[model samples]
Target: MKDTLLDLQDIQKSYDATPVLAGVSVTLSAGETLALTGESGSGKSTLLHLAGGLDQPDAGRVLLHGQDIGQMDDTARAEARRLHIGLIFQQFNLVPSLTVGSNIALQARLAGRHDAAFCTTLGHRLGLSDLTTRYPEQLSGGQQQRVAIARALAPKPALILADEPTGNLDEDTGDAVLSLLLDLVSETGAGLLMVTHSPRLAGRLSRRIHLSRGALAAA
Candidate 1:
C-alpha cells in the first residue's frame, strides 16, 4: 500500500475567541492533486498552514508519513518541513537579492539535495531559463511566480502545499503556471494540495475540496 503523505484529523483553529477552522479532516496520498477552495475567511489558508506545519492546530492531529508532527518541537517540525514539505505562497516569496537561478536552487541546497540539472531543467519547463540571470525584482509577476514554483519544487518533497500560488498572475500567465505545476506534480509523483479561489483552476485538478466554517466537503 502507498503511504499517506499528509493527514489532518479534526483540525480546529481560532483567533482569540473567534473560530476559523473547526473539525477539519483531510488526507493526501502520493501523486494526487487536490485543490482547496472557499470564499474569503473560509479557513482555507489556516488549513494549509496547519497541514504544512507552519501553524499548530488548536485541536487535532497533524501527521506526515504516519508520524505525529504536532508532537514535535518547533525545530524538529521545521526540519520535517525542510525535508518533506515544499511550500508555495501567494506572494511569490522569492528572495529579492538572489538571482532567479539561485532562488530556484536555494532550498534544495539548504536541504543538502541540490541538483543543478534538475533546477536547470525546471527553469526550462517553467519558461524561466532566460530569466535565471535576473533577480526577482527584474521579472514580471508571472515570471516571479514561476521562480517561486521552481524554488518550491527543486527539493522534490513528498507533499507540495501551494497557497493561492497563481493569485498574482493574469489569466494567461496563471494558465501557464498551472500547467507547469500540474505537469511537474505528475512527473514527480508528489501530492499537491493547492488553495485557490478560481473555480476554473480548481476544476483542472483531480479533486476539489471546499472549506466552510472550519469543515471540509468534497465539491
Candidate 2:
C-alpha cells in the first residue's frame, strides 16, 4: 500500500462565523492524483490551504505524512510547507523583483534542497530555459503559469497543491502543461491535489471529488 501523504479529518473552517468547509475528510496517498471540482465559493481552495498548512482549520486535524500540522507552531507549519508541499496558485504569485530563475529557485532554496541541475531540467521541459532572465511581467499569461509550475516542482516536494494552475492558458497549452505536471508527479511519486472546474481536466486524475455548500460528494 502507498503511504498516506495527506489526511484531513473532519476539517471545518469558518470566517467571521461563515462556514467554508464542514466536516470534510479526505486522504491522499503517495503517487495518487486527486482532482477537486466545485462551484465558486464551494471551499475547494480553502481545503487546499488547510492541507498546505497555510491556514488552520477551525476543527479537526490536518495531517501531512502522519504529522498533525494543526498542532504545530507557526514557524513549524511554515517549515513543513516549505519542506514538503509545493503550491501553484492561480495568480502566478511570482516575485516582481526577481527574475524567472530566481523565483523558481525560491522555494527550493528556502527548504535547503536546491538542485541546480534538476531546476535546469525543469526549466528546459517547461520551455522556460530561455526566459530565465526575464521577469514575470514580461511574460504572457501562459508563460507565467508555466513558471509557477516550474517553481512548484523545483523542490521535488512530496505533495503538490495546485489552484486552477492552467486557468490562464489556452486549451492546448493547458492540456500540455497538465500532462507534463502529471508526468513529473508520477516520476517523483508525489501526491497531487488540484482544484479545477473542468470535468475534462478532472477526468485525467486518478480520483475525483466534488464540493458543494462546504461538503464533499462523489464526482
| Model 2 per-residue lDDT tens digits across residues 20-84 | 99999999999999999999999999999999998999999999999999889999999899999
* Error of model 2, residue 212, in angstroms: 0.7
**Residue-wise lDDT of candidate 1 within 1-219, one digit each (tens)?**
656888898888999989999898898988889999988889999899888888888788999999888778899899999998899987787888999999999989988899999999989988888888899878888788878888999999889999988887788878988897788778888899999999999999998999877777655
Candidate 1 segments exceeding 4 Å error: none
Question: How accurate locally, in lDDT, is each candidate?
Answer: 0.88, 0.93
lDDT of 1 at 160: 92
Model 2 ranges off by over 4 Å? none
The TM-scores of all predictions, comma-separated, are: 0.94, 0.97
Root-mean-square deviation of each candidate, in angstroms?
A: 1.4, 1.1
Model 2 TM-score on a 0 to 1 scale = 0.97
